[model samples]
Target: MKNKDPKANFGIELDESIQIDGVSATATKFGESFRGIFRWQQSFFKLVWKQAIIYYIIYVSITLFYSFALDSGNQANFDAITSYLARYTSSLPVVLLLGFFTSTALNRWFSIMASMPGTNRPIALYVASLKEDAADGCARVDLYIRYVLLMWLLTFRIVCKPLRKRYPSLMSIQAAGFLRDHERLLLEKHKEQPGGSSKTFPLVVYDWLNILLRDTCQKGYFSVANDFGRNIDAIQVLKKGGGNVIKFASKNVPVALIQAVTLAIYCYGVVSVLSHQIEKHYLTSVLSGYFPLPYALPFFFYYAWLKVGRIAIDPFGSDEDDIDILNIFDCHINGAMRLRNCYGVKITIPSTDRSAFSLS
Candidate 1:
C-alpha cells in the first residue's frame, strides 16, 4: 500500500504503484559485489579447510591432555581436566554464536561507512582502516562479538536439517519482485515531484533502493522466508512494518539471540558425546589411536559442512552470482559525478579505464 502524503520521508512511503521486473539496478550491483567476495570456490574451500584444521588441532591437544589426566588417576588432576574440557565444550557454541553476530555487525558497519559520501574508498581499505583505529576499540570489540555470533549461527544452521529445509528459490524471486515493484514506484514519485533535481532524483532513488534492498533481501525473518520457503509467522510482522526496514531491525536481534542459544545447546551435546567416547575408551589399547581420530572427525565435518553451505546459500558472493559489485559501484559513482556536474560542481576522474575496475 502506498502512503498518500509525499512528505513522509521518515519511513518508506510509496506514493505510486508500479510493477517492475527483477531486482533494482542498485540491488543487482550490491548483490554482485557480495557474491564476488563470498562465491569463489577455491577461496571458500581454503577458508573452510583452514578453520577445520585449526579446530582439529585444538581438539586433538585437549583430548590428549584429558586422556593423560584420566590415566594418571590423580583425583585433583582428573577433576581439573574434566572441568576444563567441559568449559571448552560449553564455550564452543558461544564462540560460534559470537562469530556470526560480529560478522553481520561488521558487514553492516562497513556497508554504512562505505555508503557515506566522504568515504569513497574501497571496501577492503575501509575494513583495514577501521581495524587500525585504536580509538574505535569498543566498536571493534562489538564487531568482533557480532562476527563470532554470525559464524556460530551460520555453522549451526548449516548442520540443522530444519534450517536447511527453509531455503528455496521461488521465495527469492518473489521477494525480488516485491522489491523491484516498490523501488519503481518510489522512482516515479521522485520524478513527478516538483523542483526535484533530475540528477539528484536518480542518485537519491539509488541510495534509497540500496537501503531498502538491504532491509528486505539481505538477511533476517523476511529474507529467511523469502529465500527459503519457511512457513515462519514473522513474515506477517514484516509486511506489517509497511516496508522491510522495521522488520529487519525488529527481527534480527531476536534471531541472533535464538541462534546463539541453539549453538550453545549444539556444542554441549557434541562435548558430552566426545567426553563419553573418551571415557569409554580410556586406558585401553584402542585409546592411543581410536580416540584421536574420532575426536577430530566431528569438528572437522562440522566446519567443512559450514563452509560448503555458506558457499551454496550465499553464492552471490561468488563469481557466478547474478550481481556484480564493481559495476554497481561504478554506476553509482558515475551517477553521483553526473549529478555533481549538473550542479556545476567540478570533479575529476582518475582514469576512465581504471574507474570501473574490480578490486579482485
Candidate 2:
C-alpha cells in the first residue's frame, strides 16, 4: 500500500500575532506547560543531532576504510576505534535513562498540581465559596493539569515504554469534563454580574471596561472550542476514537498517511546507512558518522507535528471560537439589577447617544 504524507495531510498555517482574550485560565496553563516542554534541554538534543548527522556519516565511512586497510596490524588504532565506539554506544543508554527520570519528575509535578485545591476559583472567592465555586474550580484545575500531564505522559510512553500506548483514551474523559466545566463556570459568572455599577463616575468608563474584559476573557472559551473541535476531527478520521486506526480515512487521512510514510522513509534511510557500515565491518564508521540521524528525525518530526496540529485545529484562533463578549456584558448588566432588589426586567444596551438609550 502507498504511504501517506503526514506533512501535507496535517499542515495548517496560523497567524502568528493574533491575540486571544477570553481564554480559560486552565487552557492558558496548558499552553504554558507545552511551551515549557518545548524549551527543555531534551528538546534541544534534536537540533544538535541534525547538524551532527552528516559529519558522523563521513567519520564512520573513513574509520571503516582505515580499519580494513590496516589488517589488524595497528593494534593501537584498533583499540582506539573500539573504545570510541563503546563510548558512543554507551551515551545512548545514558540519555535514555536521563530522559526517563526527567519525565518521571515532570509527571510527579503535574500530579501535585492536579491534586492541589482551587485552580479554578478567583483568589478572592477561595475563602467564601469553598464548597461551590472554589471547590469546583479546584477540581477543574486538577483535571486540566492532569489532562496536560497525560499528553506529556503519552508522548513519553510512546517514545519510551511502547507498551503503554493503550492508555491514551483513559485521559480524554477527564480532559473533556474539565474543559466543559471551565466554560460553564465562566459563562455563569459572567451572567451573574450587573449591567452597570455605581463604582464608576460617568458610567461610560465602566461600560468600556466591561466590554474589554468580556472580549479578553472570551479567548479562554475559544480555546475550549478549538480543543473539542480537533478531537472531533480526530474521531471522524479514526472512525473509532480510542483505537489505533492504521487504516482509517478522513479529511486528515492524507496527513496521517503522509506523516507515517515520511517517518518510515526516514527510518529506512538511517537503517540502510547503518547496515552498510556494519556489513563492511566498519564499526568506527557507524559510531562516528551515522549516529545522529536516528536521534534527529524523531525530534524534528515531533516539533513539526505540534505546529501543524495547532494550525489545523485553531486556524482562526481566539477570533473564531471565542466566547461572545457582548453577550456576557449584557448578562452581567441584567444580573446586577437583581442586587438592588429591583424586579424590573428592562436592561438597556447603552448607546453612543445618551438620550437614545436609558434604563428606568
Candidate 3:
C-alpha cells in the first residue's frame, strides 16, 4: 500500500498504521522492500485461506469415502469418472477468462480514481478569480466551496458506506457545517417534490450553485469579455465528475460475466479434486490417494486472482483493499481550508532592479 500524502492529509490526525512509513520509497528495493507476502492485510493468503481450507476439507472427505467406503465396482466407476475429468480440465479456458476479467477491473479502478473530485481544484480557481481588499475574496469563495463540498457529500454518501455512516443524515451534515438549517429543510422538502427523489438533491444543490455563479458573474466579478464564465465551467466540470462517479457506481459488471467466472473457478476446483490424485505407481498402483497439496497452491492463486478482480471491479467498498474514500474527502476539506488562507498576500517588485546576470 502507498503512504497517504502528508501534504494533503494536513491537520487531520488519522491512525499511524494507515500511513505506512516507506512503502512508495522502498517498493523497488527488492531485497529491502516488497515484503507484502509477509503482510496479513490485503495478502493473497489472507484473501484465499478460508476458501483453501474448505476446499481441503471436502477433498479429505472425498478421499476417505474413496479409500474406505468404496467397493471394487464403485471404485472402478470412480476411476472412470476421474479419468474423464482429467482429460478435459485442461480445456476450461480459465486462464483467458480470468486474464481478461482482472485487467478490465483494474482499468475501471483507475478510471474511478481519475473521476474522483479533489476539492482544492475549484477553490484554487475561485480564490484567484475573485478580487477584494485583503482576503475578502477568499472569504467569498469559501461560501461557494462549502456548497460544492456539500453537494459532493450529498451524492457520495449514497454511494459510499463510510461517508453515509459519517454523516448519517442531512441533519448531521448541518451540524458539521456542510448543510445550513434552511438548506436542509429545502433539500428535504424538494426530495418530496413530484420530480425529485433523495438522489436528485445534488441537482437541486447544483441549480443553487448555478444561481450563485450567474449572480456573481452578472455583478462583473470577472471582466465580461475575458474570463467571466470560468467558474461556470468549473462547476460544470465538478458536476460532470460527480455524475461520472455515480454512473460507474450504478452500472456494474454484468452478472453473467461474474457468474461465469465464479462457476468456472469452483467447477474446476470440484472436477480437479475428482481426478487429480497422487500416484506412487499406477500399473500395480501403490499409493493412489487424494494428496491435495498440488491443488492447494494453484487453487489459492486462482481464487486470489478472481477475488482481486472482484475487489477492483467496485473499489468503492470499505474493505482493506478498497479505496479509502473517507480519507480523500478529509484530505480535500483540509487542503481547501489551507489553500483558502494562503492567497491575497502582499508582494513587492522594484521597478529599477536589474537582472542578476546583467553585465553593465
Pick by TM-score: which candidate is best?
3
What is the TM-score of each predicted model, taking all chains together?
A: 0.29, 0.23, 0.83
Q: Number of the top candidate by lDDT?
A: 3
Instruction: Give a tens-digit lDDT track for model 1, residues 1-360.
Output: 121223322221111112122424254454654544454444545555665465556556655666565465654565565557666764465446545645664454334223222111211121222223234433432332222222222222222233223322223312422124554455457768886533333244334323433443333423133432221122222222212221232233345554564466457545644453344443753463344555545555554444443333332233332122223323333332322223223359676676688876
User: Considering only N, C-alpha and C atoms within 3 Å, which residue pairs clash in candidate 3?
Assistant: none
Q: For model 3, what is the alpha-carbon lDDT of residue 291? A: 51
Tally clashes: model 2. 26
After superposition, which runs of candidate 1 have C-alpha atoms over 4 Å from their true positions?
1-47, 66-254, 265-291, 304-323, 327-360
Residues 9-93 of candidate 2: C-alpha lDDT, one tens digit per residue: 1111111113343332254554654554454332444434553466466546655565565665564555565555544442333
lDDT of candidate 3 over 36-103, digit per residue (tens): 54767677778988887788788777778877798878888888888899898888878888888888
What C-alpha lDDT values do all the predictions have? 0.37, 0.33, 0.74
Error of 3 at 355 (Å): 9.4
Superior candidate under lDDT, 2 versus 3: 3
RMSD of each: 22.1, 21.2, 5.1
- Tell me the lDDT of candidate 2: 0.33
